[model samples]
Target: MSVYARRRRRSGTLMELVLTFVALGLLALLTLSGIARQSAGEPILPWIQPSSGNHLPHGVNYQIDALDPTTLAPMATLPQKGMVELRLAVTNDSALPVTFSFPTSMQCEFVARKVHTYVGGLFVLPLEVWRSSYFHNVSRHASRLTLNPAQTKVYVANWTLDPFDTGEASAGTYQVSASFGKSTIPLHIDKPL
Candidate 1:
């Protein structure tokens, strides 16, 4: 073969190899992107089987329960200054499947007592709402969760409480609650030690 023709063939082969590699690289990139979108932190989450509840006569029935995070035990009272977790378990009582949307952050507040005291001089503090900083800047995206008939789903939310404005971390009973829609779970908190 002529030198000119040989050089042309070699150039064409190199161009073909480059184009092939470019196409393969793009295909790999597309595949990796799809995998990344589907994998939402699988390393942190364990697989949980769906549990079914008994069919009820009413529609969706929701029960809110307070639990201690450290022990995973049910709680009736919490400490004055610590994290409180409220689990809202919703049972689909109707025959139809229901979809509910709730924010990732939970809304909660504290209610203090107002009484006539000789030492504290009529100590009465107004209600204090615990603010969550999770979705402060970005607009919160509500999660659309669905529950089939007779299926129960429990959602957990936590709130950390601080002392009163007057630094009155005194020994007194207070009420704290987490509310979702019209349903709420009210629990008492003992005085901070």
Candidate 2:
């Protein structure tokens, strides 16, 4: 091939390669912005759910339910600014007394109410950070409760959003469940009025 012809061919190939990369880069930017515009925010996945009939292993049944402490009624959704208490009704099927140990702190999540409650983990991150990081569990102490066989006692863990918190504590479906030994349940929570 002639020298000039070979040089021209090589430059054309190089230009095509650069144009291809520029097109791909523009395409990527457009795709990412479209995704960002579609989502309200990131989906929260805080607590891992279980798949089985019973997770409690101690022959003790722990039914985790929620109560509106003010109304003293069973609740499906907790008020955003009010208190919703998690009640653990413990029944020992065994023939002996079992001591129940509640975790230091129970977790609550905002979720979507539907066929399945999708947990919103990040929604409550600010509250958690305020509780643990700022407060640091000050003045908290250890306590345990014992239950007799065939007896069912209800234990409570209450949660509420601070009225002054101006953050996005949106009203929607939420759940609060605690694990005792190897069992846990999800409590339903609703957004504030």
**Top candidate, metric lDDT:** 1
Error of 2 at 181 (Å): 2.8
Question: Mind giving the per-residue lDDT tens digits that candidate 2 earns over 108-146?
Answer: 222222112223232232121112123335234445667
lDDT tens per residue, model 1, 1-193: 9999999999999999999999999888655543432232111112333122323235987665667889877776655666667676768888999776656433322233312122232222323444333444634565566779899877676755554445444455554444544344445555535
Report lDDT per candidate.
Answer: 0.53, 0.52
Evaluated against the true structure, the overall lDDT of model 2 is 0.52
Give RMSD (Å) of candidate 1 vs. truth: 20.1
lDDT of 1 at 25: 100
Winning candidate number (TM-score): 2
Where model 1 places Cα greater than 4 Å from the true spot, the runs are 1-58, 101-126, 129-143, 161-170, 182-193
Badly placed stretches (over 4 Å) of model 2 are 1-54, 99-146, 165-167
Candidate 2 colliding pairs: 77-190, 78-189, 78-190, 80-192, 171-191, 174-189
